[model samples]
Target: MLVTLREILEQAEQGNFAVGSFNSPTLESVRAVTEAAEELQSPIILSHAEVHNDIIPIEIIGPIFIQFAKQASVPVVVHLDHGSNLNIIKKAIDIGFTSVMIDASHMEYEDNIRIVQEVVDYAHKHNVSVEAELGMMTSSGIGGEETQGGEHHATQEAEDYYTDPLIAKDFVQKTEIDALAASFGTVHGIYVQEPNLDIKRLKAIYENIGRPVVMHGGSGLEIEDYVNVIQSGVRKINYYSYAAKAGAQAVKEYIQQNQNLFYHDYTVVAKQAIKEDVKRAMKIFMNNGY
Candidate 1:
C-alpha cells in the first residue's frame, strides 16, 4: 500500500528496525525494490533524486512509481530525494510522491531553514511528508559528478559541515521536517576505504533532535555499522550505488557466461539480473526476514 513517509518512519521507529529507501531510476529498479519488499514482508521506500528526474523525466517515471507502490503487498512510500529547488519539490508533490526531501544543506543555515520551512508549509498543506538535510554529505561517486558538474571526485574529510546536536535541536524545532538526515561522519557514494561511523555523535544528535533520523550514503557501510546506526536512531537508510552496480554486474556476468547471448532477450536478462540483486540486498536490509 502507498503510505506517507511519516507513517513509514513511525512504524520503523516503533518496531526498532530501519526501513530501506532505495533509488529507482527505471522500471527494472522499481520492480527489484518492490518485489524484494513484498517477498521480505518489509516496508520500503522507492526514492528518486532530482538528478534522476532529469535523466528519466518525471512525466514518464512518476505514474509508474505510483502504480508500483499501489500494487506492492507491503507498505511503500514513493519519495523524492535530494531535491534542491522548490519548484522540483512541488512537482514531486503534485506527481503523487508521498514524501519530498528538500536538500538545501549546501546553503547557509538560515537560508536552508527558510527553504525547508517553505517546503514544509506547502507539503503539510497537501498532506505530504518532508525530509530536510542538516549537513552536506560530500561524495566520491556519480553523485559528486552530478552535484559538482563533473568535477573531480574528492574524499570528504571529517569536517564540521554535519549537524551539531545543539543546532540540530533548533533546526528541527524551527523547520518541523518529518525526518532529519544527519551527516555524522558518513559521506555520499562509495568510500575509497572503510569509513568509520561515529555512533556516539549519531546517538547524541538523535537524542537532541527528538525525531526519527535518516542515514544517507549507506551503500558502503559495514554490517556492524548498519546495526549500530539503526540502534542509535536511524529509522531510514538510503542505498543506491550498490544496488545499481549489482544489477549491472549481474547482467555482465550473464552475458559472459552465455555463448548464444545474441539470441537472448534483453528485458528478461535485465529483469532477472535486477531481481537477484534486489533479493540479495533485501536479505541484508531485512536480515533474512523473508
Candidate 2:
C-alpha cells in the first residue's frame, strides 16, 4: 500500500529498525525495489533524485513509481530524493509523491532553513512529509565515477561536512521537517577506504532533534555500522550505489558467458541481481541481523 514517509519512519522508530530508501531511476529498479520490499515484508521508500532528470524525466517516471507503490503488498513511500529546488519538488508533489526532500545543504544555514521551511509549509498542507538536509555529505571519487545519482564522488574531506548537533536541533525546529538528513562520516557511492562513522555525533543529533534521522550515502557500510546507526537513531537510509553496481556487475558477467545478447536478456539478469542486492540491504536495515 502507498503510504507517507512519516508513517513508515514512525513504524521504524517503534520497531527500533531503519527503513531502506532506494533510488529507482528505471523500470527494472522500480520492480526490483518493490518486489524486494514485498518479499521481505519491509516498508520501503522508493526514491527518484532530481539529478536523474537527464537520465529520465520526472514526468515520465513519477506515475510509474506511484503505480508500483500502489500495487506493492508492503507499504511503500514514493519519495523525491535530493530535490534540488522548489520546481522539481512541486512537480513530484503534484505527481503524487508521498514524501519530498528539499536539499539546500549547499546554501548558507539561514538560506537552507528558509527554503526547507517554505517546502515544509507547502508540503504539510498537502499532507505530504518533508525531509531536509543540514550538513554537507561529501562524495568520493577515488574509484571510477562514484555514483549515477547526485550523491557520492567527491575528493573533499568528510569531517569538514559533518553536521553539528546544536545546529541540527535549530534547523529541525526552524524548518519543521518530518526528518533530517545529517552527515557524519558516510559518503555517497562506493567507498575508497573504510568509513569511520561518528556514532557519538549521530546519537547527539538524534537526541537533540527528537525526530527521525536520515543517513545518506548509505551503500557501503559494515553490518556493525548499520546496527550502530539504527540503535543510535537512524530511521531512514538512502542506499543506491552498491545495488546499481551489483546490477552492472551481473550484466558484465552475463555478457562474458553469452553471445548474441539482446537488451531484455541482460536487463533481466540486472533486475534479478538488483532485487537480491536490495533484499540483502533491507535485511541489514531491519537491524535484526547483528
Candidate 3:
C-alpha cells in the first residue's frame, strides 16, 4: 500500500539496495511503475516533476498517484521532484504526497540552508518526508532554461561543482532532510558518453552524512554504475527519460509496422514498453529482484 519515502528508503538502507524513483507524467507511466513493483515485490517511488506540471498539473496528478499507491500490492510512494516553490510543495503535502523535494541547490549554501530548513521544519510537522539537493547536479546553473524540471544535470560542473562533503554534512545536520541528492558524476538524460562515477566522492558524502543518499538523472547510467551507487549507499535513484522514451519509441514502431494503427493499440504498446523498462530498472536497483 501507500508508504512514506522515509519508510521506503529505510528498508533499502538496511538491505544495502536502492529503490528507483520513476517519474510519471501520465497514467500509463504510473501503471507501468506499479506493475513492475508488483512483479518484483519491490518498493517503488512514483514521481511527478514540477516542470511536467504544464502537461499534467500536480494537482490533477496527485490524486491519481495516491490512488495507485494505495492499490498497489507492494509499497509505493508519491513524490514531488525538484519543487522550488514553497506554496506548491505545501499544496503537494496537503493533497497527499508521501514525499516532497525542495531543490535549493541553485542558491548559495547559506540560502539553501535557510530555505531547506524552512521546508524541513514544515514537512516534519505534517509527518511528510523532505528531500533537498545540496550540490549543483547539472552544469547549466540554477537560473538557466533547463533547471526547471528533471533536466539531467550537466557534467561540466563535475570538476569544480561537486558537493563538498563537509558542507553537505553540515547541511544535513542542520536541515534534517529525510534524504540528500548530492552530485558525484551522474547527470540527467542520455549520456553523450559514458559517465565515470566518482566513487570516492560518493563514499565520502555517504560517510559524512550517514543518511539515505539520492541520485538524480539516472536514466542512462550503466548497470555497473548503478551497482556501485547502491553499494556506495545511494538509497534512491531517479529514473525517467529512459522509461518514457522506451514507451514512445515502442508506440512509434508499432504504428510503422501496422498498416492500420488504432488508438487503443498505441496505449497498449506504450504500457507494455514502459512496464518492461521499469521491470528492467527495478531488477538493476534491487540487484536482480530482491
- Taken over the whole model, the C-alpha lDDT of each candidate is 0.80, 0.88, 0.85
Worst 10 residues of 3 by lDDT: 139-148
lDDT of 2 by residue, 1-290 (tens): 99999999999888899999999888998999988988889899999988788778999999999999898898999999988768989989999999999888888889888888899999999999999898887777542223432344455566777899999999998888999999988887678889989999999999999999999889888899999999999999998999999999999999999988899987899999999999999989875531
Query: For model 2, which pairs clash?
Result: 139-154, 140-153, 140-154
If scored against the real structure, what TM-score would every candidate get?
0.92, 0.95, 0.94
- Runs in model 1 lying further than 4 Å from the true structure: 142-145, 148-156, 262-266, 288-290
Between prediction 2 and prediction 3, the one with superior TM-score is 2
If ranked by TM-score, best first, what sequence of candidates would result? 2, 3, 1
Decoy 2 TM-score against native: 0.95
Residues 1-290, candidate 1: write the lDDT tens digits: 99999998888887788888888888877887887788778898999878886679877888899999998899999999888868888899999999998988877889989999999999999999999988777676654225522112344356555668889999999999999999877766657767867788899999999899998888767777877888899888888877776666767877888777663455556767666766665566566221
**Which regions of candidate 3 fall more than 4 Å away from where they truly are?**
139-146, 149-157
Q: Candidate 1 vs candidate 3: which has greater TM-score?
A: 3
Alpha-carbon deviation at 276 in model 3, angstroms:
0.3
